[model samples]
Target: MNKPDPIPARLAALKTTPTHDLKKQWRDLFDSEPPPFNRRYLESRLAYRIQELTYGGLKRETVRRLERLGEELDGGDRKKSRVRADRDRPTTGTRLLREWQGVEQVVTVTADGFEWQGRPYRSLSAIARAITGTRWNGWVFFGLKNHRRGA
Candidate 1:
């Protein structure tokens, strides 16, 4: 038998603790400067820390298993898997609105590809080219990537 951790009870009681006391508690638990987040964030993170410290983290085998499952579900080809990455591709059912030559263009995200003007396109770059009649980076044209001022 092992003694139970007292940190969880203390974390639950954080709701009633004063702001100053909460700061001190944060320092004691994290041994670092407390972030400037609200009280709710502090309490939740502290509670998670307490629970993590009380028990142990996940095992290496579990992480590897999850990764293997993800690779299996994604079909395991680098080029094929790139389409599912969230960085540049919009989620399914999302609508992307753009304006070109004073006309508003709407593109809807589908499971397989994007739909624009009653037509299906393989890539946003193709859509951008069709709209502008010139080659352009799709993410830049759609304002997904940041553009620096005075380049």
Candidate 2:
């Protein structure tokens, strides 16, 4: 029996063909069951051949063709190319107090707490007391109130 020509010979024959055409031929070659020794050796060598051809060129068309060939080699599934977003994406939260019902009606007090118009000064009492010397009366006052020596 005669020895068959190697895959390198076959790949060399394909060099002059268009990239897509070469990929199709290669796919056909891979699909066919070569002899046992030929199968293992050809698979590894063909992969290296592809990578060599891909990175050897600077042309955009060459790069695109290489990418296409890579896609076909990995089972021709476009879904595999998709990437999931990382969990660290920034997020914002709403603060109820930041948006008061009627901000104009709300008062700032020497004693901490908000005083809303038509509503008694009942919220943020501790905040007002901690910030101001006296109790808040729902009026938006900025200046410090005089604290008596004993009150």
Candidate 3:
């Protein structure tokens, strides 16, 4: 006869199920990609931190630990990309959109880009479309260069 592991109990107790739909939240935050990004905005705005990583993103070791813990907890869906590290650059204008439906928004993404607001909108039109759908009244565009605030 042995005592039960307190670690399990503590983890179980700490396992707070994500309250807000991650998809929607992720979508909303997705609008802001590239650089000068702040994932914290989304977490603070939503009042929750569904993603396990930290404000500065997760360290490799932490990710592994989390994955291991998750597996032990019967949650083993965390998969790591096998692609090479050097090929992570944005070679073209192609923007990758990662949608999380829970928050009702889109994550306009690119290998080289910047984040504005919590959502990672690539262009004004995309943002407009997000807020007003395809038929809404407005237009948006991104110039090839960055303009100064006064200009």
Candidate 4:
């Protein structure tokens, strides 16, 4: 019978090893300089790399299936075209502050929408309406999009 791999034991020991020693081990295992990630991230990725080396990586068929699923979910070409549009928008947890009628209003970006006055709104327009009692384009109201005429 083949001898059992020693990677598991080394992975367990990695947790207790000092950062400097871990960096040296990482260099040996990966044959490259260690990244600037934290100790936990380094340990976890190292453990994964050790296991992958001992028991081979995912099969080509599995990788192809994952790519197919990703393309289907993202709608392929449609998703690629929208990438630039999505990049122009603010990310979640961003805070937007605006002053209207001598009162300061604060809105926070969320994963699914925006939050204002401790309430969730599906769009910035809804939050702006609640704040100003008038209809408004949310992206323009929040200064997220330009409203100037084309030169």
Candidate 5:
């Protein structure tokens, strides 16, 4: 006969377990204090930990493969990866249009700069200044900075 699976029962118990017991379980499993999270979060993470402890976690080869992919994606530099992922520049050939003083201004993104009024400009801040006659942040003026993936 096949052995019965205990993972389901253990996971189900997480829902019925007292909050203090869940915190103690978390400390025992993770070897650290429980994070200041809601009960649901605590229960879910405890369930995962219980399952992992019983059945084991990811294989060494899978972890190595993931690390290799991460290195290729970010050149193995965590800071550079963060900076690159946060950059919000639009792709080349994108056209940005804005209305200023009842006149429409158009700007085109190029491989190396931006084009406006048939002239190439080095920076978007310069373009915003040319349009408004005052200093303005190009990304904010163009309404793109506020749309970041994670604020």
Candidate 6:
């Protein structure tokens, strides 16, 4: 008789596990403190960790291929991407719409920054300035938080 597969059982158990236990498992498996995120995030990461420990991680070729794909969008510049992440900028093709005073404002996200009224803006603050004629926190004006979700 073949031995029963334990991975499925292990994965199933994660759904019912307490958040604290999941955090501990994350610490044990990752050897680091669990990030401050919601329970869903913890469960998913823990599930991946369990599977990774059982079946080895992705092959080097797959990792390299993914990196190349990311480079196509990130321009292979780690520093610039890191800064963009800090700013919590939206991805390309995102449209931000807001109504101020009596006019509807529209901003389209681009790799460099944003475009509004056929003008390229280096920052959201610039767009906000053009719309309101006053200094404002661009993210706040655009109804977005300064930080992204704990992704």
Local distance difference test, candidate 3? 0.41
The whole-model C-alpha lDDT of candidate 1 against the native structure comes to 0.75
Q: State the lDDT at 114 in candidate 3.
A: 28
lDDT of 4 by residue, 67-126 (tens): 888778666566674674456557889999999889999998777667788767767887
Candidate 6, residue 18: CA error in Å? 0.8
Instruction: Quote each prediction's TM-score.
Output: 0.42, 0.19, 0.22, 0.45, 0.48, 0.57
Candidate 4, residue 138: how far the Cα is off, in Å: 24
Colliding residue pairs in candidate 2: 108-140, 111-134, 112-128, 112-129, 115-138
**Tens-digit lDDT track of model 5 for 71-138:** 99988889898676445557789999888889988999877678888877767888899889899988
Give Cα-based local distance difference scores for all models: 0.75, 0.41, 0.41, 0.79, 0.82, 0.83
Model 6 C-alpha lDDT per residue in residues 1-151, reported as the tens digit of each score: 9999899898889899988999899999999998765566677888888888899898999999999988997888989888867567777989999999988899998776688887667678878987889998888899885456634
Itemize residue pairs with steric clashes in candidate 6. none
Clashes of each: 0, 5, 19, 0, 0, 0
Alpha-carbon RMSD of each model: 15.2, 29.4, 15.4, 12.4, 16.1, 12.8
RMSD of 3: 15.4
Best to worst by TM-score, what's the order? 6, 5, 4, 1, 3, 2
TM-score of 1: 0.42
Model 4: how far is 108 from its true place, Å? Answer: 16
Q: What is the lDDT of residue 47 in candidate 1?
A: 74
